[model samples]
Target: MTNEQANCDTMVADPVVGDGCRRYVLPRQRPGDSTGDAPRVAELKCKVAELESQLRDLRRTNDTLKMHVAKALGLQLDSPIPGAGFETTRGGKAANAVAVSRRTAPGAVRGVETQVPKPTETPTGVEFRVLGPVEAAVAGRRIDLGAPKQRAVLALLVSQVGQPVSVDVLLEELWDGSPPPSAITSLHAYVANLRRALEPNRAPRKPASVLRTRGRAYLLDSRMVQVDVHRFGDRAMAGWQALDRGDPQRALREFDAGLALWRGQAYAEVADTTHVAPEVVRLEELRLWAIEGRCATLIAMGAHEIAVSELAAFTQAHPLREYGCELFSLALYRAGRQADALAMLRAHQKRMAEELGIDPSPALQHLEREILHQAPSLG
Candidate 1:
C-alpha cells in the first residue's frame, strides 16, 4: 500500500475519530480512493459533529449545577469547601435551614413543599476565664472541660482570642515542640470536643460560631465569648490613664476593679506550659503595677495607713522589686516612721548587693539622703 493510504487507514481508526470529531479535519482522502468510501466518510464526520455538540451541552449543564450549588452553600466560587469529616455548615443559619429542608424532603415536588423544622441557633453567651485556672461557661452554667491537655488548648485559644492559631503552632504549644505521632489527630479530637461543649444544641453539621475554622487554622471568636483576661487589661489601662491625668480617685477605682479579677496565680493550671508561661508572667507583672498605682493613689489622697499596710504585704511578696520597696519606704516616712523608713532602705540595699551583686538604684539612694537630712519633701 502507498504511504498516504497507510496513514489514512491509521487515522480512520484513531480513538479521537471514534469517540468524536478530531479537533481539526483529518487529511483529505487520496485522489484514487473509491467513490463508495467518500459517502461513508461524510456520514461519519456528521456523526462526530453531533457527538461533540452533545458533549458541549453536557458541560454547560454541569457548570450551571456547580453555580447553583455554590449559591445554595453561600460559598464564593474560589473558596474551598471544608472537610466533610468535620462539622460542615452550608453557609450560615439561613443556608443551613434551607439545606436541612431539602435533605429531609428530597422527594417532595417543587410546588408541594415539606415543612422541615429549622435548627435552633446556639446561644452566644459564653465566657472564658483564664485569670486563674481556665474555665468556660455558657449561659451562666459552667462546662466541665475533660482533661489537662484539653484545658491547655482552651488556655491557648483564650490567650489569643479572635486570632487564628495554626495547628502546627498549637501542637508546639501543647507539647512544647516534642509532640507524639498522634498529637495532630489528638488535637483535632480536642477541638471537636470543645465545639460540642461550647454548643451542645447545635445541629450535627452546622459550623461552630464560637470555635471556628479559618483556612488551616482555628479562631475563637472574641465577639462570641467574654474573657476575663481581656477585661482585666481594659480596666488596668483605664486606671493607668486616670493616674496619668491626676484623677487619683478614679485611678484607684479602676485599679481595684482590675485587681479584683485575679482569683489566684494567672493561668495557674498551665503557667509552666510553653504557650502560657509568657502570658502568665505579663499578667502577673500588670497586677503588680496595678497594685503600685493603687498604693500611690492612696498616698496622694493622704491615706498613708492603708498604703503602708498594702505595700508591706506587697514588698514582702516581691522583695527584689525596687519600686515596691520605694513605695513602702515612702509610706512609712509619711506615717511618722523616719527611722523605720531609713532602716527599710538599708535592708533593701544590702539584699540587692548580696543577691544581685549590685548597689541600690539611684532613686533609693537619693531617698535615703533626703530622710537623713529630714528633707521637707518627706512630708
Candidate 2:
C-alpha cells in the first residue's frame, strides 16, 4: 500500500479504455529507448523502392503496348493516344476524336473515354476538295485525320457530304461487320476531333457547324462546304431535265458545268475500300451518261460538227454503250456524213453481236436504216 499501489487502486475503468487496455495502449518510452524505429523505416523504404521499380516496368510495358497498337492500326506515332481528346478537321470545321488514354495521373479515371471539346474557330469558307484524292482543308492547311479507320469514317461522311449518315450505316462501312464496343463513342470522338481541327482558332463565340447530330445519325451540312459530287449531280440533273424539256441550249450549259467537275475519279484516295468502289463506278457511269447527254444536247443545238468529233471519240472509248454509238451515228448523219454514220453503226452492231450475243435494239436499228438511205431529215 505504498504511493504507487495507492495511484493504481484510485484509477477507475474509463469507457474509452475497456478491460483490455494494455493490449491496445502503447507504453511511453524513455529518452534513450529509440532502438526499433530505424529498422522499420529501412523496411518501409525498401518496400517503396520495390513498388516504384514495378511501376516503372509497368509503364514501360504500357508504352510498348501502345506502340504496338498504333503500329498495327497504322496510326501516326505522334497521334494523340486513346483518351487524349484532340481536335482534327472536316469541311473546314473543328472535330474531336477520342483520345486513347486519359490516365493523366495514376488512378486518374483510366480507360474512361470522353468527348473532346470542339475547336473554337469561325470558318470563313468551307472548301470542299473532292476533285482529286478527296482531302479537306481549313485555315489554309490540311487537317490531320488520325488513322485509316478514322480517315475512312471521314471519307464516308464526306461522300455523303450533305446528308445524315446513320450510325449503323457508318459502322457497316467502317468495320464491315465487326465493330467494337466503343464504336459509336469512338465515332463521336472522331467527329469532334474533325471539328476541332477544322476550326483551330477559338473565335466567333461558337464553332462553325459543319457536322450536325441528327436522330441516331450525323448530318454533314452541305452549305458548310463545297462538294464536287453534289455540284456534278445538281448540274447534270438540270442538264438532263432541260434536255427532256427540249431546251437544248440550257441543257448544253448544264451538261458542260456538270462535266467540268470531273477532275478525276470521285474520292480517289478512298478508292481502295470495297464500300467506295461501287460509288466510284456509279460516278463513272454518271459521267458517261452526262457525256452522252452533252453530245445529244449539242446535236440538238445544231453543234453537229463539234458533237460528231467528240461523240466519235467517246464511242471509241466506250464501245459497249449502244446509246453512245447511236448518238455518234445521229451526229455524223446530221453533219453531212451519211456513209460514215452507216459504217459506224454497222461496226457497233457487229461488236455487240459478237461480244454479248445480242443484236441492236429496234431504235438503233431504225436509226441505222435512216442513215443507210438518203433521208432528207438527216439535216
TM-score of each: 0.63, 0.56
lDDT of 2 by residue, 1-379 (tens): 6753443332221111112111112223336544576753454455456545644544454466457644442233442222211111111121421111001111111232211121224354555556556667775677676777776777777766556788888887676778889888888888777777665663654744776778898766665665566567667767766754556677778989888877777777676566567667656766786787787767766677998889878987899877688778877876888889889989988998999999875446646755675433344
Lowest-scoring 10 consecutive residues by lDDT in candidate 1? 97-106
User: Could you tell me the lDDT of residue 53 within candidate 1?
Assistant: 72
- The clash numbers for all candidates, in the given order, read 0, 29
Instruction: Write out the backbone clash pairs for model 1.
Output: none
The TM-score, computed over Cα atoms with residue i paired to residue i, of candidate 1 is: 0.63
Model 2: residues with Cα > 4 Å off, grouped in runs: 1-124, 137-150, 162-190, 201-208, 213-218, 222-225, 244-247, 272-274
> Candidate 1 at 356: error in angstroms?
1.9
**Candidate 1 residue lDDT tens string, 117-192:** 1112325878888888888898889998888888888888877677888888889888889999999999999999
